[model samples]
Target chain A: MRFAEAWRVALDALRANRMRSALTMLGVIIGVASVVVLVAIGTGAKREVERQVEGLGSNLLVVVPGRIDIGSAPAVSRLDLADVDAVSRVVGDPSRVAVTVASGETVRAGRRSDFTTVQGVLETTPAVFTRRLGRGSYLTASDVDTSRRVAVLGAAVAGALFGDRDPIGQQVSIAGVRFRVIGVFAPLGQSLGVDRDDEVHIPVTAAHRLYGTQRIDGIAVKAPDRERIDDLGARIVAELTRRHPDTEFSAVTQQQILGVLGDILGVLTGVLAAIAGISLLVGGVGVSNIMLVSVRERTREIGLRKAVGARPRDIGLQFLLEAVLLTSIGGVTGMALGVGAALTADALSPVPAAITWWSLALAFGVSAAVGIVFGVVPAQRAGRLDPVVALRAE
Target chain B: MATPAIEAVDVSRTYQLDGVSVPALRGVTLTVAAGDYVAVIGPSGSGKSTLMHLLGGLDRPTGGRLVLGGREVGSLTPPELATLRNETIGFVFQAFHLLPRTSAVDNVALPLVYRGIGARQRRERAAAVLGRVGLGHRLHHRPNQLSGGEQQRVAIARALVTDPTVLLADEPTGNLDTVNGQAVLALLEELNTESGVALVMVTHDNEVAARARRRITMRDGVVVADSAADDPPADSAAVPDGPAAGGDADPTAGDGTERAEAAR
Candidate 1:
């Protein structure tokens, strides 16, 4: 038979049992839609994390005491202010170096008090990191040299301590010491699950006195150029290791961190897509089952057509076409539904969703293939039916 | 003689049911020529339907050669046999076996689909044949929408649409009322005479068998008699009878007293 004619017959059969056709398509619809939606969610999350990582700064390198690699325990870290000076000489840009020590402390300003994270930082903090002041002047190098009791408040800390009140000239007590708030950082929300806006910054020398610790937590350095980042990290780690032979230091670049994170998210996306594919497999089986039932129901019709003139191949093609049609239509509908759902979820909630064309194409191709894989036995059954027995079937 | 529309030489068929051998046609020999009208009458389970299937190339004989339109059925592959059936034979069943939801014209056009005819021409030919069967006005009516007689006429039109040399109709009038049966029977006779297509019908009704130019009677997996055997097979390719021969048809048309006439 002509190809168009075969399609016409298949179409007629579906139209003849519209309710059955739609019900059979439901399984594939859900399967493809879930795959698209879930993959979108995974892609959206990976992108969000990338944006956050990139937001830290350009050509940024972090040097920490000890090995952060798997299967290695970190040695007791002894990185102090003198080590920071050694790192500054290695980079040849002292203004690009910054150190930090973090502790949770309670701050009292008049009648209002807030428990917040207090960080020790240098005057080069804003230069090495992408931070801005919303009010007042930031800490100066003289303030760190004098061990002055001055502080920079984060946007949230300032709000909590002095609700909409200008905090530049105000006094707040931190770790039981009175300090003047020198500045308030801009409204940066959250990064890597930590509230960036709810912290206070003090001079490194003053923090050491308050916390009774001579060790700094970590160091961040900005490389002069992107191409020298890896070399710069290695040089810094070598210098730190040179100063304290007993302690090992590791310097990590942003790219390496992103690679690790991207690998993790890629696996997550694949896993979610695979889980949704199980539903497609189930949907394929449903198509096969429905095709079998259709063959059984149309046995007499098959007999009649064969008696007139249809070859076994023609009959087989008809049934196979029916199955393919069912899945392809369902696949398209599912894609629309999944895209709509993903966009809706992205818009209404914090969960990010991005619809990638590859995911859509993969879902469509697999759904069609599912029809073929699941449709074969039933179509063969229809073609192989004995006209004699089939004609006699009630 | 025009390659004999069908020739079965001692064709025998045995079916296996759960390892039990049951013979349906025990070496029955027959020949049906082009432009012939023959009726086969027998009770149920008598191998009459089996004979029709073998004659139409729907089944293979176990014992002898069966040639359809000058091609040996045994030598043809299943697909080749299907094509042969499509080219040379058409069928009408007692159930009126029309695709239930399709319009009459489309149902009639079905046979031509396997012939690779385009849609427009298929429909045109189908409509022309349906008009000849007195159903020109019911071209768009589905089976459920049409009366029983109209449905049977549509089936007849489908059979004739292929322009086959032989039309194998198994109990063509069995599913209709008395009036519809008479109408269907008359239409079959008319199409047979008007188109000169060979007609081979299997019927339980004796009166329906009597209108044919020849009659074949089967019993117990064998053909016991054929009414026109006295005449040469080629001579039996006469035209079908007129409408006047319906009620007062020859009682001897199903004449089977000449027993064991076809182990030839």
Candidate 2:
């Protein structure tokens, strides 16, 4: 039989039961939409993490002091300035090593004093961490060499201290000790949903001597290149292991952290997406059930067509085409709704959702497959019907 | 010496219901030459419809050597039989089974579609045939929009569109009024005379049977009479008395030899 005639018959059948066809398609729509939205959310969160990690530069490594023994239990490690120098000697890269000591204290600019996080860092911290200056100039090597009491304010700190005025070459007091603001750092938007432009930067020696603290809290090291990050991280771990055998130090490369985060998100997205995919199975079953009912209802129409000279294959193809068309239309609509949801969620939240064309193609392809898989039984029934009996049926 | 247009040898059909075989047609044999108009008349249980279904190749005979258009029908596959039915035989039913939602033209074009004809040519051919059957004015009207007689005419138009050698109709006028029935019969007569396509109609009306050049009367799964009338039954029948004379006002009611007497 002609394909056009078969399609005409199928379209007529669809028009005959428009409401039933639409409701059957709704199942597929919900299934497709669920998968799209779920995958988008997971991928969006992952992309946000990647952006943050990349912002920290690909060659960076973070060293956080692990558990240490106290009176009765393990206490946090008491990492010090000596450990930073020892780490630097073993690594043999002066530009890469930087020690940071931080404290929460009130800083006064003129008459206003605000409670903000104050960090004591080496002169090379900006270079090591890839931090850029938005105004004036950054700390020079002479500043850290002479243990100068100079400070640099972050974008948020400068705004809070001077409002619309420039804070370069201005004096700000930390813990009642005045320090010159040499520069203001550029604004870094939220990283993991926390504003990073709100802290104060100062030389490490000034922070320890002024606050009467003897310990350094953290050290950030930069490798020469992305390929050396893991090797450098291993070398630093070996040095730290030899220097402080009893102290537990955890050295994590940025790539390792990124991988771990990606793995966790992958598992989460996979599970959510798998559960969402079950709806498609239910939708497929829904299609088969509706097709079965349709075949029963149109038994005579099929018989008449066959009697008038329709081939069994023609009847089969007609029913199969109807099912495929229904699911495909539903899939397209569901994909549209899914993309809209992803875009709206991205617009309103911090997650960066990117809808790709491949995802939409996948949705439609699955929908068409679902149609064929489910349409088989009903199409076979319609094709195999005896014209004599079918024509006699009520 | 030419082969008959339709042939059946010792054809028998049986139905199995609740594990019991109920015989419908037993050891029946018939033949019709091309261009002949014949009728098979019997009571409801005499298996005329079963014979018609078998003759049209809609169903296979349970036991028979059947041949149509010089091919052994019993050996043909389902698809081959369907092709033969489409090319060589056309059927008209009592119910006028046109697809409910389609136009009359579309219903007539359905047979051509099954023949793998293109859309444009099929539509044109369908319109042409509808015009031949005097349904050109109702080309786009659906079955519900047409009168009973008009719908049957459309059904007849559909049957003739393929130009089959034999037209197998089962009670073509069973659902129409007397006047509409006569009109349909007259149309069939005219078609047979003009086109010279063999016409085989199943009916219980003696008056309708009288119009055919040949008649076969069946009783209890067997052909009791097969005759060619020099003077048709209507011209000779005026006395209405008993079952032996085949004179029941209800033509379907007849005795054992009534079919033979009526044929003579």
Candidate 3:
């Protein structure tokens, strides 16, 4: 028999039991939709992390005072201004290196006291990173050399301490010491779960006297180009280790950080998609059960058809086609629902979501496969029935 | 004469029922020629239904040679036999067996679906046959919408739509009232006379059997009498309750010609 004719017969059978068909398809719909929505959320989170990392600087590298490998404990701060100079000599560019030493402290400007992160940084902070000034001027090399008490207020810190008033050149006290605000940093929201706009920046020498710490927290450096980042990292790590001698130091490039984060998110997405697929498997089982019931209910009809002229293969194909149709329709509906949910999630929720074309295709393909895998037994049973005995059935 | 539509030579069918062998047909011989009108009459479990099943190719004989449409029944595969049935035979069962929720024309057009015929031609042929059965006005009616007599006529149309050489009817009017039964029987006789298609019927109604040109009576898996040549035995038709309604006949001792003459 023609495939088209078999399809028509299958469609007719499904139409004869509209409620049962729809209920059977519901399983597959939910399975496919869950896979789509879950995968989109994972992919969206991964992309968001990548955007934040790239925003900092593409060719940037960081050197910290520890052997920053798996299971290694963080060490005491062994990096100081001398280590910064040593890194500058190896980089052959002074403005390409910046160092920061941060601790939480209260700041008071005309009795508006706010407790926030206060970082001791060099004049090269703006040149080494993507941070920008909103008003006034950034610190100069002469300010650090003279141990000048100048501060660059973070967006949030300035808003809290001055309340929208221009704070540049205003006097503020940190740890009982007075300092003049040199600039205000632009507004930057949270990245990697850290609040970027909730801190203060000041010349490195002044913060050493206020916090009474000789060692810096970490050093940031920008390579001349993408290709030389690894080479620059190796040289800086060797130079810093040589200077400290007794302590271990590590230098990491931007690609290494993004790669590790990507692997974790990728696995998470796969796991979620697989969990959703279990529901699809259950849906396929429902289809198989219904087909078996239909065969039993129509035994006399099968015998009649066989008595007239239908072959066993014809009967089997008709039943198999019915099952495939059930799941395929369910799969399509589920995919649409998933995409719609993903879009809705992206618009209304903080949880990021992005639909990948391949996820939709994979979900659809798996649902069809589930139909064929689960449908085989019932179709074969229908085909193997004895016409004589079938005709006797009520 | 032309090749007989079906010829069974000492064919037997033994069924296995839960580790016990139950013989349904034990070495029964029969022949049905082209355009012949034959009726099979017997009590329940007398092998009349078994003989019908074997003759129609819905089953195969366990022993002996049975030829249908010029092909040995034992030699053809299941698919090949199905195709042979489509080309050479049509069946009208007691239950009518019209697909529910489907119109009469489509039910009649089903057999042709296996013949690779286009849908339009199939419906047209089915409509023409329905017209011959006097059911052309009810072409679009479902089985539930038609009376028992009209349903039987629709079934007859379905059997005739393929233009088969032999039409097999198993208790064709068993489910109908007397009036509808007579009407369906009259329609079958008219089709047989006008078209020259061989007609083979299995019925328990002695009056129905009397209307046929020939009759074969079976008992205990064997043919006890055959009026294929002359006439039914004198005693066989006299029992209004039906010959063999007694339901017990010698299973191992019966020759077709001798027993028929002995009864006379």
Candidate 4:
């Protein structure tokens, strides 16, 4: 028999048992939907991490203080301005490096007070972190050299302290020291749960005086090109170890961070897909059960068809097509539901969620495979029925 | 000479029931030429239905040879047997066997579907045959919507749509009332005489068997009496009481004998 005829017959049978067909499809729908939603979340997080790392500069590397074993206890090692300068010299180009030191503090503007992070940074901070001024000018090299008490308010901090009013020239007290706001940085949104828009930036010397600490938190190094980032990171790590022989520090390139993030997210996506696949297996078993029952119920009809010259393969194809059609419809419905859920999540929450084309294809492919895998037993059983015995069936 | 439409040479069949053999047919030899309307009648468990099944290629004999449409039924593969049945034999069951929730036209078109015919042609042919069975106006009505006579007619249309060499009907009117049964028998008579299609019917009713020009009475899985002159026996009283016993009651009986003679 032709596939078209078998498909039509299958459709007719399914239509005759509408409630049973729908119930059979429920498992597949849930499986596909969960897979789609979970994969979307995983991909969304990976994309968000990539965006944040790119924002920090594509050819960037971060060098931070690492713990050192002093005697029987683990001591927190410090990285000072001298070590930053020494690493800059090792980098061989003054134009390729920026350094920053941060401390959490309470900032008060008249009656408005908010707990926010304050960072001490050089003039090159704007280029290294891709921060552009929304109003007024960024700090100049001369400002940092003179240790001027000026600050740059992050977009969120500016909004909180001054509301709609411009805060570029306003005074804000940080750790009980008042400083003029030099510029309000452009909005940078949140990434990996950190709000980049809710921070204050000041000169390194001013931050050191305010926080009573001369130690730097971390140093940022920029490669001339993406290809040189690993080499630059290696050179900075070697130079830091040479300068502070007893202390420890580690340098990580943006690529390393992205690779680690991808591995973690990829595993997460795989695990979620596996869990969803179990539901698909359950759905397939359900299809097999229903088809077996259908074959038993329609034994007389099968015998009649056989009497009319239908071959065994024809009957088998009809039932198999019915299974495929059921699962495919469920897959389509599940895809729509999954995409709807992802879009809803994106709209309501800070975590990004998106449906990719590959995920859609995978879901459909798996559903079809499920149909065939589960459809085989019942189809074979129907095909192997004895026509005379089947005719005798009530 | 052309081969007979159906010929059974000492055919026998036995069923294995729980390691015990139950014989259904034992050495039943018969010949049905093309265009011959033959009825096999007997009481239950006489193996007449087994003969019908073997003739239709629905079952193979455990022993002996049964030929249908000039092909040895025992030698053909399962698929080849299916094809033979599809193209050479049509079956009309006692139950009508029309698919429920399906229109009469679709039920008629079912045989053609297995032939790989396209939908448009299948529908056109199904409609034509249904019209022949006097169901043209009721083509779209489902089986449940039709009366017993109408449903039987639809089943006849399905059997005839394939234009097979012979129609094998097992108690075709067993589930119908007298008026409907007589109507169906009359229709079968017309098809055999006018269309020249062979007919093999199994019936318990002597009145129904009387309509056929040829009659075979089975007892204990063997043909006890055959109306055809070639199979005459001394004990002719074994022939049941029917118009078919006289042989001259049917106007077309002479023509059937002449055709059988010409083939030989």
Ten-residue region with minimum lDDT total, candidate 2 chain A: A67-76
Cα error, residue B71 of model 1, in Å, equals 2.3
A1-394 in candidate 1: lDDT tens per residue? 4577769878988888999999989999999999999999999999998888888888899999987774576556699999999999999989999999988999999989999989999999998989999989899999999999999999999999899789888899997899999899999888767788999999999999999999888999988889999999999999999999988788988888888889889999999999999999999999999999999999999988888877888889999999999999999999999999999999999999999999999999999999889988999999988888888889
For candidate 3, give the lDDT of residue B198: 79
Backbone clashes in candidate 1 total 0
Better of 1 and 2 by TM-score: 1
TM-score, prediction 1: 0.92
Rate residue B195 of model 1 by lDDT: 78
lDDT of each: 0.88, 0.81, 0.86, 0.84
Which digits, one per residue and each the tens of the lDDT, describe model 2 over residues A159-223?
Answer: 98899998888899999999999899999877766678888888888888888887888888887
The number of the candidate with the highest DockQ is: 1
**TM-score of every prediction relative to native:** 0.92, 0.79, 0.88, 0.81
Q: What is the TM-score of chain B in candidate 3?
A: 0.87
Chain B TM-score list for all models:
0.89, 0.85, 0.87, 0.87
Model 1 CA lDDT for position A386: 84
The superposed Cα distance between candidate 2 and the true structure at residue B92, in angstroms, equals 0.7
Q: Across residues B141-188, which tens digit of lDDT does each residue of candidate 4 receive?
A: 999999988898899999999998899999998998766676677677
Compose the digit string of candidate 3's lDDT tens values, residues A14-47: 9999999999999889998998999999999999
DockQ of each: 0.64, 0.44, 0.52, 0.55
Error of 2 at A344 (Å): 3.9
